[model samples]
Every structure is written in C-alpha cells, then in structure tokens.
Target chain A: MKLTVLYFAWVRERIGLPRETIETDAATVADLVEELRGREPRYELAFADLSALRVAVDQELADFDAPVRDVTEIAFFPPMTGG
Target chain B: MAVRVQQEDFDFGAEADAFAEGRADAGAVVTFTGLVRDRPDGGLREMEIEHYPAMTERAIAAIEAEAVSRWNLVDSLILHRYGRLRPGARIMMVATAAPHRADAFAAAEFLMDYLKSRAPFWKKEVTDAGAEWVAAQAEDEAALGRW
Candidate 1:
C-alpha cells in the first residue's frame, strides 16, 4: 500500500520534511511508526515518544492501534495548542 | 452554523450582528474572542500559527455540530486565523446563539474548550530571546472533562 504521511509543527522541523509518500505493507498505525523508525535516526527521534504525539488516519483522529489498511493519508503532530 | 479557517482577521461586530440577524427566536448571543497575548516581559514580537488546512475545517465543523446537538443552539460560528500575528491581534472567535443566556454561554465555552485541545492548529510565539512552539497545557485538556 502507498500512503501519504504528513508531519506538522515541531515534528515537521525535527523530521526535516512536511510530507512524504511511503510504500509499505504495514497494517496498523503502530506498524507504520516502526517502519518509519527503521528508516533513519530522524524518524526515530521524531517518534521517540508516542505519548507526546497524536495521529490522524485519513484526516480523522485515530489511535496508534488503529488499522491503516486502505488508508491514503496519515498525519502525526504534537498535542494541539489551538484557540 | 459557520466555520472558517483563514489567514485574515475578522470583524467581531459584523460577525456578531450577522449571526443574530433574522434569528429573533435567539434571545441571547454569546461571543468569545481569543487574542495573541504578549509575554510577561513584554518583549513578544509576533505569534505564528500553523494548521493543517484541510483537517482544520473538518475538525471545527465536527466540533460545531456537537455543540449544536448538545445545546440545541440557534446558530454557531467559529473563525480562526493562521499565519503571523502580532500582539493584541485577534487569534480566533467563537460565537453561539440560543434562546437563553445559559445555553449560549455554555455552547461558546464548549466550542472553545474543544478548539483548544482537539483542533489541529498550533501556535508558536516569537520573542526577543527566540521562537518556541507553545506547549499544550494540562489545564486546557482538564477543562474538557467538565463537558
């Protein structure tokens, strides 16, 4: 499956890019995180603490354990400080 | 219901008036405006707000729908600005109209609470020392527990 992953705020700064396309067989958000972690140290550092981050699958907020099959987009960012 | 996410400032008076127009049944209209506060030292230069453009609209619309359902609101409005803004600039606004003051006020607060924690926007404050992304406070998340 091909997925478009987005990073925002400090996560984007740390990861050095805003978005990317990755081809993977990962079935869950966690699995995708592991795949990204194996790619390089920057991803490992950006994803160092999953608790400090949030995930959205297909633009809707989802848990890390959420399934990712057939999902086209995924975004990861720090806790929002909006309003 | 109206939800807007843009990089431009909005007129509060016009928005409030427009929200109440033709809604004679709504006896009360409550509005809350969020501003960019300067640092305590008074050296803040600007605030940069970043957001996921596509997701921001969808998220605010969902929040507005929840508020409408929970409070039976007559109408609701949410306008948030991104990009660079200086101190005293309006950051966002949430307005709610209802038959009574309680519902209007409550719905406005509920919208703000959800917007602060659930929305996709992130704020970074720039000061004379440096620029830093504003961290989400625990108190903001705790505020949602009351709802």
Candidate 2:
C-alpha cells in the first residue's frame, strides 16, 4: 500500500520533511511508525516518544492501533495548542 | 455554521454583527475572541501558528456541528488565523447564537473547549532569544471531560 505521511510543527522539524510518500505493507498505524523508524535516524528521533505525538489517519484522529489498510493519508504532529 | 481558516486579520465587531443580523429565531448571541498576549517580560517577538490545512477545516466544522446539535444553536461561526502573528493580534474568534442566553453561552464555551485541542493548529512562540513550539497543556485536554 502507498500512503502519504505528513508532519507538522516540531515533528516536521525533527523529521526534516513536511510530507513524504512511502510504500508499506504495515497494517496498523504503529506498524507504519515502526517501518518509518527503521528507515533512518531522523524518523527514529521524531518518533522516539509516541506519548508526545498524535496521529491522524485519513484526516481523522486515530489511535496507534488503528488499522491503516486502505488509508491514503497519515499525519503526525505534536499535541495541538490552539484557540 | 461557518468555519474560516486564514492568515488575514478579521474585523471581530463586523463579523459578530453580521452573524446576528436580522435573525428572528435567535434572541441571544455570544462571541469569544482569542488574542495573542504580549509576554510580561517583553521578550516575545511574534507567534507562528502552523496548521494542517485540510484537517483544520474539517476538524473545526465537525466540532461546530457537535455544538449546534448539542445546544440546538441557531447559528455559529469559527474563524481562526494561522501563520505569523504579532503580539496582541486577534488569533481567533467563535460566535454562537441561540434562542436563550444559556444555550448561546454554553455552545460558545463548548466550541472553545474543543477548538483548543481538537483542531490541528499548533502555536509557536518566538522571542528575542529563540523560538519554540508551545506545548499543549494537560488542562486543555481535561477541560474536554466537562462536556
């Protein structure tokens, strides 16, 4: 499966890219994270602390254990500071 | 319901007035404006707000829909700004209208409570010394439980 992954704020800063396209057979969001972490040190650093991060699969807030089989988009970012 | 996310500054008074204009069904309207506060130490330079564009709109609209349904609001508006903002600039505004004051006020509060953490916006504080992303407060998340 092909997925477009996005990063925002410090997550983008740490990952050194705002977005990327990856091909993976990962079934869950956590599996995808693991695949990315195995790619390079930058991804490992950005994903080092899952507690500090949030994920959105297909533009909806999703859990780490959420399935991503048909998901086209995934975004990772720090917890929002809005309003 | 209306949700606007932009980099341009908006006229709060004008927007609020327009939202309430000639609405016979609504007797009470409440508006809340959020502004970037200047640091007490006077060391802050600007606020850099970054957001996931598509998700920001979707998330805000979803929350607005929830507020309208929960409170039976007559109307609602959410306008948020992104990108670089100077201290004292209007960062965002939320307005809610209902037949009664209680519904109007509560709906506005609910919109605010959710917007603080649910929306995809992230704020970065820039100062003379350096710049840092503002971490989301735990209290903000806990505030959602009140709903």
Candidate 3:
C-alpha cells in the first residue's frame, strides 16, 4: 500500500525530513516503522527508541500495534505538550 | 457547538456575542482565553507549535463531545489557532453557556484540561541558548484524571 508518513518535533529534527511517501508491504504500524528503520541509518536512529515516540494512524492517535493496512497516512512524533 | 481551528486571530467579544445572541435559555456564559504566555515554566524565550491536522481536529471534537455529554450546556465554542505564534497571542478559547454558572464553569475547565492533555500537538521552545521540545506536564495529566 502507499502511505504518506509525517514526522514532527525532535523526530523530524533527527530524521531531517518532515514528510514522505512510501510504498510498503507492512500490515501494522510497528511493521511499517521497522520497514522504514531498515531503509537507512537515519531511520534507525530516528526510531531507535520507540517508547519516546508516538504514532497516529490516519491522524488519529494510535498504538504501535494498530493495523496499518489500507491506511492513507501514518504520522510519527514525540509526545505532545501543546495546550 | 462550534469548533474552529484556524490561522487567523479571533475576536472574543464578537465570538461571545454570537454565541449568546439568540439563546435566551442560556443564563450563564463562561469563557476562557488562553494566550501565549512568556513562559509556561519560566524557562523560555520563544515557542513553536506543531500539530497533526486530522488528529488535532478529531481530538478537539471528542473533547467537545465529552463536555456536552457531561454538562447541561446550551452551547459551546472552541477556537484554536495553528502555525507560529508569538507571546501574548491567543492560542485557544473555550466558551460554554448553560442555565447555571456551575455547569458552565465546570464544563469550560474540563474542556481546557482535556485539550491540554489529550490533544496531539507538540510545542518546542527556543531560548537564547537553544531550542527544546516541551513535554507533557504532570500537572496537566493529573488535572485530567480528576474528571
């Protein structure tokens, strides 16, 4: 499936990119993350610590185990602190 | 109920007037305007806010729905702005109208707490030294637990 991924805050800083479109065979959010992590050293470093990062599927807050099949987008970022 | 997420500034007086305009049943109106403070913890010079477009709106809508379910509110309005904002600029607003002050006040506070803790928006502060990402405050999480 084709998916647009977004990174924000420190995650964006570490990754050096804000958004990208990727085609992957992953079925879950965690799976997709691992796919990205394998593509480059930067991805590995950016996703080194999953606990500090948060994921959202199609713009709704989601867990790492959430299914990603047919998802149009998946965003990864640090925990929010905005009010 | 009205929810607005925009880049432009909003007029509180005008918004409040429109909210209470033809609603005679609304005996009490409580509004809270959150401005960009100099420092949330006395450790900042400038702040940058970033948010997920779809998630931000979904989260706010869910919070508003919760307020409506919990309070006997006649109407409610929520306005939040995105993009770079400087200090003293309005960040958000929550206005609730009900038949009594108690419900209006409680609902307004509840909505603010929810937005602060649950909304998926990240804030980074830039000081003279460097920039640092802000983390969710324990106080905010604790406030949400009270509900």
RMSD of 3: 2.0
Please tell me the interface RMSD, in Å, for model 2: 0.5
Report, for every candidate in turn, its global Cα lDDT versus the true structure: 0.94, 0.95, 0.86
Each model's chain A TM-score: 0.98, 0.98, 0.96
Error of 1 at A31 (Å): 0.7
- The TM-score between candidate 2 and the true structure equals 0.99
Evaluate every candidate with DockQ and list the scores.
Answer: 0.93, 0.93, 0.70
Candidate 2 vs candidate 3, DockQ winner: 2
**Which whole-number lDDT from 0 to 100 does residue B98 have in model 2?**
93
Worst 10 residues of 3 chain B by lDDT: B38-47
Off by over 4 Å in 3: B40-45
Q: Tens-digit lDDT track for model 3 on B74-122?
A: 9999888877777788888899999999999999999998888678778
Q: Which residue pairs clash within candidate 1?
A: none
Supply the global lDDT for candidate 1: 0.94
Model 2 is docked with a DockQ of 0.93
Could you give the interface RMSD of each candidate, to one decimal? 0.5, 0.5, 1.3
Candidate 3 lDDT score at position A33? 87
